[model samples]
Target: MPRGGPVPEFDTIVIGAGMSGATAARLLADAGQRVVVLEARDRVGGRMHTDRAAGFSVDLGASWIHGIRDSRLWELAQALDVPTIEFTVGSFQAGGRPIADFDGAGNRMSAAESARWVADVATADRALEEAISRSAPGDTYLDVTERALDALERREDALDPERIDEIREFFRHRVEEQCGAWIGDLDAHGLDEDAIDGDEVVFPQGYDELPQRIAAELDVRLEQVVRRIARAADGVRVETDRGVFTAAQAVVTVPLGVLKAGAIAFEPSLPAEVADPIARLGMGVFNKVFLQFPERFWEDGVYAIRALGEPGEHWHSWYDVSAISGLPTLLTFAAGPFGRHVQTLTDDEAAADAVAALRRLYGAAVPDPVARWITRWGEDPFSHGSYSHVAAGASHHDHDALAGPVDGVLHFAGEATWGEEPATVGGAYASGARAAERVLGRPVDLAAFAEGIRRSEV
Candidate 1:
């Protein structure tokens, strides 16, 4: 809460004005504490950027609400009355081919085929679960999957070897898409974190609105790229390009990527518990290539497109996000290693590749794009990569260590610090609130802050 009269310093200095910092600052200030939010970029939302360019409001970063029930974000969305849209899974790709009908539902995988697949996919899911259940500590998801796949192949009723491979690749891509890392990098034991149960949704207007609203009543200083954090006689001293500020306490909400990159220097050096995780935990790569075409060439009612037969893993998923800009827009994703590889391409190269992939699926009717926006989170200085994931041999307890306070001088908050919902906006915000509580020496209901949120008029 950047609220309060002019003061020489502050009671708390919240670093990085993303969802986490914004929530921490707001909660602390409302509780009568002086707080200042320091953001590296000249904006409030960190990775939740709602890029307004070429007369379109497009989210270059996060867009979806993975789960809705018991969602702090959903509660806040309701309080703010943010406009939302639901995109049901409408297409599938089997053996590298689209099951969606081009003209209508007639070409789609038939009901019988759909039922058959449902059963097969269900079995695959069960295999994954069983593998996870029997996995040894420190085992990677890939290891668990291999064991499951081998057992399935030995089953008398197993499908052809090619089909089995397809199923394996399907789950591999899924984990890559969801965790933002290859299956080999995922820790089998850390996979099943708590989650909300409900339909998935996205902000058709812009996901950035949530952070913008939460930070409205607070004082957020933009373009203040933090470089170093140190313990001071008074409290904590934060050094930024613009200047320096000292506060009674500091809450760092920067992305785990930033920490992993050693961007901010710590004064006495963080303890082994914190430093170990920062070194061992994985920072994943996930990029987006949003293309706005001259006209819609794909079928209507298709929310997503997945092609297992794609030559490369670059185009992991394509989400139709025309609702945001009312244009013929489709945003495709690149995850895992390809997510990193795509960063090497020039803008034209990347956009052209995305269009080429679309052509393969939709035919030559796919025209040249009108406008394009691409991201390379792996190259961003502030956020070194997309997000955090529990890497192989890394325990979910790593999140706990990252969140743990250092010498009662430094507190932590970010998606990487929360295990239940790591890599999620809601989890980040909750971690912020929790950090603020630690400084306030009290407990506060997170739901109470939902009232301060509202959708922007845009």
Candidate 2:
């Protein structure tokens, strides 16, 4: 952790101290391998950032831990004694009307609907896995992604002949809104399983605390900007704006955006197998504009506001974090294209828009925020983007390709690279533990690692 000393390289080095990188560092360190985590940002918790300057804490990056019971982060939080607040699901207000009250129905899954959706996703997942296996010896991720989606569509009718068009359109729209692509900005004749498939979790206390808890005992150098990674037969040399450090093996856990932008150059350029996946995998920009009000303005308890008024407008969905409790913070989400557009606006502009939207729904009880924070993951050189999502015609296999080791010296870990739960904090933790197991001789069952992870910390 020293700033100035002999370049101390290790058996492995993990880059980017986000959930993925931090988890990998913990597992490796626990395994007793000398490890170093190179973080580009001044602070820890890559995307899990929380701003508590105001009376209430606002998450600048990730705010929720989706799927708590099965989440490794949940166990980590319990081990660290971090507070856990139940995630409340209520009405989603859109178009000046409540869409549906999801409090009781939030966790509801229709028998037919669940079966159909699951089957569809499973077929797509299988097709993508096949495509990855059949990819040309060194095909780029973009090439593989295209083929993967094509393969899914080729077999689409078999999955659901009656709902072919519906399923295709369903996947397409999902890719636009959820896959990090701006809605309606893109068109795809083929379907993307990776983009359409996956589940989500929410964190009541915010996702940032999970990482801070995990990094509590580690030696982390804050405000460090990694510039380059030099790999040699002897060891790897890592150059950062803060200082240079060396480790036997380096786990590069930085965001895919940084990897794609060539923010941290390698002594030798990465191969297509390594570099292409980073490029092909999309680093989505999911920004949240948190606005604090003096009083609860709306009659509805805690609800989600979905803005679908104009043809092209941002602020798609807003949620009252205090739905469970009586907090005054209203958190809203805009991803893909909308998030990018909002990023160009000023904080005041963004805050004003949120307030205006509230006034439209709740009258005038909600005044301008006493404090506001806008998440700029896309603009952060270290993060480059929010979380990674598979684009149209892309597959999760692209992330799998990135997960493979490069020269056994440069290891990668992060949420983007996770095959399952790529966007969750638990996925990052699992990826980190997997990387550590690889560095050490220990083997872990991919399915039950979280339970074990929790047990280890507990």
Candidate 3:
């Protein structure tokens, strides 16, 4: 095929050069199939961008390798000789001081009281599980979460009203972050569907390295935004901004947010099973704001500091990047509704809010950051939000529908399609491999890749 000649037909066309797409392209190409990857952005790593800023390897997109055991990401990192460090959640801070719990009036809970609160929260969780199991018609996760919190509040008589309100706010933030949706919009039953067992690990070299390594030898077409996917009787035609590419099989690896936004129009239109899940499944926003300081100001051994604030506040959780990156950097996270709200603010405004929140903890003398970076995944055309979650009335079956292929022509692969581990790089990698297996008509031994990680641990 010449450069300007008719678009060369490939055995498979993988869309969006993210973890899933890159993995699929690599696997398919290695299987002796001609593959071409189409990516909307100029870069190969879609939401796995790693850039050097202020002399530090900063991951602007995906950060954590998540799990080591049975993790494809961990396996890939091992193959590439990438270093990883265990990431642990640290202490909670309020009003610039370490505390288990704090009231609005600046009173902190004693160790005994904090222990009791933890027990109460556990009880509330059990109650919530029971409530979700026996949920009535029209019941929303928000209703159940509030009911659980109210039950806990009523049982804890020792706490003052102000203290109770503060605890409630904290619980709200925790639930929203876990569900990746506002309490009112989350499905209580589906919250535990995607839970995976294991400690999270960080890629010190940068999370993007895994995808970049996989896509190194693949024919990836950058800045080719796909507009329409028309499946004919014999093959599939992918119309992009640049040109049309035909392939016997096409794997759609774009983010759930982009799919929900209807960025690519299907010629025959997606069936109800696929389209309905796309509508029901929620696209979550989990953006990060990184601030680099000249020196570390926060305490050591504390990976995360919880800044007590009202519900839906943008800067509720602050991560100490100094622990892993060996740099004086504080990474703040905004998720769910708060994350969406933060996306609406200007870069300076969002940075100012995060700085003010930090000042509340560190005092007025906290020096201004020498460099700052904010990520707005919601605003990006390729990835409208961070990841995917089950909406209020949706179930895990929605994920199955999203992953299901249509007419053996169009296949879907992304983090959202992996119901067992949705919204993680590991899931995205597995999904891509699974999609390639579907095209190959045989199961690939993905578990074999993790043997190295298992042997290293032993």
Candidate 4:
């Protein structure tokens, strides 16, 4: 019913033109398969959008390649000859005053501070793993897991087993730094540990350039939001707001949230196992608030400032875009539950709150911004959130459930479905490649790619 015109046909149909779908479509098309990509938005790069209306480019979606050291996206940049700039994560200074390095005192955490956090993270991960391992691996997985985690909090190996609840509280606060704070409850626990690669890069020209360059020669139909998929014994029927399309195989690369939200429905309904993963895998909200001031206020030359707030508080971190290039832009990051709440505020309200937060740390010299831009991936219909991460007690196997194809025809690929590094752009690319490989009936070089992904963690 969402279809408007005649139903064209194809060998493969990929939905959502973000990194995952784009990669999947390109590979499939290059492999001599006729593919049609359906996107709800008017443009491609669903969450990797960059706006250049202002003098400089601002990423309305993904700003950085995240961690660049071993990133597949970084490798793609090299292959495509795309230029990039480094984004430094440095110390915190406000209003010409050294508030302190990264500490709970509302300053950028120092190397020591980061190491402390890392240790706590390692402890938390282990605690979760031990909880799962201790549980009997049968029908009572959900119940046993809950009990194990509750018991693990009392173990002496914990960061603060004596204060188990407080330890989980602190772990939640720190995970906000690693993943978006708005992530849902634990769906799958420890499959593997994917860390941030030492190298991280940002495109001075813009991240948007990469997708456009890769898609320049492809036949992309803009503004076609898919609404349904009717799979018959003969072929797969795809419906969208633009038109109807039919294909032998369909690779659905839309965000986890889109599937969970039921933006697109299936005729007979996809198997519960397939649909359940979407419901279980949570999408995280990471908001970036950018502002341009008349002049630079802090001179620490630090790339990032971590404002350690009380547990469960938002606006605890800020990035000095100026530090990277001495530009007039100031960008701040908010993740986790606090970030979800932040998505509900108006841009003006969000900016006003951020200004107040900065003023508290930086004094009055940092006046109101001349121009303000806020990225709210949470509320977007196409991508309900920015990226994906595991909840406590959830393992990588849960994600593998999403990876399983339906009738060897319907494939799922996205950052959320990646097992090694589930949230990065490189993970999305790798996931797409894996999905393509699945459709072609080939064994993926998981070991090689796993090394590459791990090498590029951020």
Candidate with the greatest lDDT versus the true structure = 1
Q: In what order do the candidates fall by TM-score, top score first?
A: 1, 3, 4, 2
- lDDT for each residue of candidate 3 in 1-458, tens digit (9 for 90 to 100): 12344444899999999999998888888778999999999988888999875555788888876557776677677766788777643322122233334323323446575566556555656767777877764567777776766665667454455455555666567655655577677776657764445766777777887787778778999999999998865678899999989888899999998898999999899999899999998987878899888787766655565544342254666777775567688887777777888888998888888888776666665678878889888888999888888787787778867987888878999989988878788889989988998999998765543342344345
Ranking by lDDT: 1, 3, 4, 2
Runs with alpha carbons beyond 4 Å of true place in candidate 1? 1-8, 88-111, 194-196, 232-234, 310-313, 452-458
Instruction: Write down the lDDT that model 4 would get.
Output: 0.67
Go through the candidates in order and give the C-alpha RMSD of each one to the true structure.
4.4, 8.0, 4.5, 6.7
- Model 2 clash count equals 20
**TM-score of predicted structure 2:** 0.74
Which 10-residue span in candidate 2 carries the lowest summed lDDT?
99-108
lDDT of 1: 0.78
> Model 2, 1-458: lDDT tens per residue?
22354556566767778887777777666656676666767778888887766544567776556556555666666655666665432211011223211111122234455455446655655664576567653344345445655666576355434334333333433454444564333223112332312223454456676666556566777777888888765567888887878876778888778887888888878878877878666677777777767766654643454332231134445666764235676777667766788889899988887677555544555676766778777788777787776654456677767876776767787777777767656667778777777767577543353344455565
lDDT of each: 0.78, 0.62, 0.75, 0.67
Quote model 1's TM-score. 0.90
If both were scored by lDDT, which would come out higher, candidate 3 or candidate 4?
3
In angstroms, give how far residue 156 of model 2 lies from its true place.
Answer: 23
lDDT of 4 at 53: 81
Output the better candidate (2/3) by lDDT: 3
The runs of at least 3 residues in candidate 3 whose Cα sits more than 4 Å from the true structure, single-residue gaps closed, are 1-8, 89-103, 106-117, 154-160, 309-313, 447-458
lDDT at position 68, candidate 4: 76
- Candidate 2: deviation at residue 187, Å? 9.0
Clashes of 1: 5
Relative to the unseen true structure, what is the Cα RMSD of model 3? Answer: 4.5
lDDT of 2 at 323: 44
TM-score, one value per model: 0.90, 0.74, 0.89, 0.79
